[model samples]
Target: MELDTPVLDDHMHLDPDHGRGIDAVEDFAHLGGTHLLVVNKPSWHLGVEAGDPDAVDPAAAGEEFREVFERTIKVVEAASDVLDGRAWPVLGVHPGLISRLVDERGFSPEDARDVMQAGIEVAAEYVADGEALALKSGRPHYEVSEAVWDASNEVMRRAFECGAEIGCAVQLHAEASEDMSEVAEWAEEAGLPAERVVKHYASGRLAGPIPSVMSEKERLRVAAESGEPFLMETDFVDDPDRPGAVLGPKTVPRRVRWLLEEGYEDAVRRAHVETPQSVYGIDTEATLSE
Candidate 1:
């Protein structure tokens, strides 16, 4: 199934041990999908233990997250063999893990934040090394104590700072709401432009960061009609335990085809090709050719 317009999944995951892995990528490609921003799962998901919360060096403890980022990069490489340069890695510590570190791993809120910020630093290094193009960071989507919340915001700021230093984008897994203007302001104050901050799994275009909305027809139509720049994703977790946890792997390309068939060729191209190129600074046409 060839496509004239490229299809890029803004957020996705592939786990060989617990999910369909690269076969999911093949499934996506089989439906004319062209690219994916393959993000790293939580540290626990990759068997990365938050060892020694009592350790003196928080940075050292954070180094454990390298395995998660590295494994994610490896997955991108493996997927790239199927989709070529279209599979880009986005690396960072999962914000939800902060709560687990404090509540489950016996880490203090401060310690958890330090460890997460350090992990973001490591992810920035990978971006610097060209292994990834964006940094993932955010406060927990659920409620938490003020201390943990402050610390999580600090960690997210570190991601913004790192992204600014390296001239890359930041993908946030923050709490879902209609307004993210405050977070956008935070990104701007940290020297990372609001446009470079993406709201992952977003439902609509908020005031601040760019929205990476799920591939639902009504949402896409609203986004397209608004004339605001946005991107689309399936957010496929690819977990075998919970089949199609978010959306299926083929959802994006299939939706693109649906949009085109419905005479939304221009909107589909803007969402799939133009918006992604502008945000990630990648030439989708060049990648699609290769």
Candidate 2:
């Protein structure tokens, strides 16, 4: 299906183990996707292989994230070469890593904050240098202790501050909750605009001033009721081991087609074209023209 307006996937992952690389990107484009916000997954220093997050050198962990951030820029460049500037990187430290540092890696809250701030600094450099478009941080609700949860929130607050300093939008990865007013409040306090904040992998039921990357499973009625300035995503993990883990790469394009068929062309245009442009500062026309 071809869309008159480009369809954007607000959040996705691409790595050797997760996103399956360029071929998967091609698949997404062939299915009518025009833009993507690709995120960098946490580093091995954060314990991707080990079930346990034993204590590691904080400097070593920071180095691991540096390497990953460099690789993430390369991935974005490669995807842009393939997709003709349709792909952009959203760089930051994952909040789950903060929990690991505090809970399993034996990091003092101060030390963990230092490491997280370091990661955010790297992300800010990328954004300031125009290599990345946005920053991301999240609180993983599951599999974290209460202390870790609270610590993650603090880390995320620092992330918001980083985004404010660097003038980059922040995409948050957290579960859908009835009350997200605190999120807006925090963003405001940090000097970040609520309109620039994104709730990644959000449900249609979510309501607030902050924008959301709605899943394909979102109800159309709920989407309509939620108001304007929303985006769509598949959150494709690209893990061969967990095929279709979150959703397929083609999910957003297909969803756009479905929405168009349902005669919601204006809504599709707003979500796919206008919202992304306003939120991420993407030039959709230039991206697709390339």
The residue-level lDDT of candidate 1 at 150 comes to 94
| Candidate 2 lDDT, 89-196, residue by residue in tens | 998887767666666667766567667766777777889999889998867857766666776787788778888898889988876674577886898899988778
Ten consecutive residues with minimal summed lDDT in candidate 2?
A: 45-54
**What is the C-alpha lDDT profile of model 1 across 1-290, one tens digit per residue?**
34787789999988877889999999999888889999998888878876578788877776788888888889998898898447999999889988888999899888888888889998999999998989999999998999999999999999999999999999999888768999999989989989899999887567788999889988888777777878889889877778948899999998888878777777877887788877889888788767
Q: Point out where model 1 deviates above 4 Å.
A: none
Q: What is the RMSD, in Å, between candidate 1 and the native fold over all Cα? A: 1.3
- In candidate 2, stretches whose alpha carbon ends up further than 4 angstroms from where it belongs are 17-19, 45-63
Q: Assess each prediction's global lDDT (C-alpha) against the native.
A: 0.87, 0.74
- The alpha-carbon lDDT assigned to residue 165 of candidate 1 equals 94
lDDT of 1 at 200: 91
What local lDDT score does residue 58 receive in model 1, on the 0 to 100 scale? 74
Clashes of 2: 1
Cα deviation of 10 in candidate 2 (Å)?
0.6
Pairing residues by index, what is the TM-score of model 2?
0.89
TM per candidate comes to 0.96, 0.89
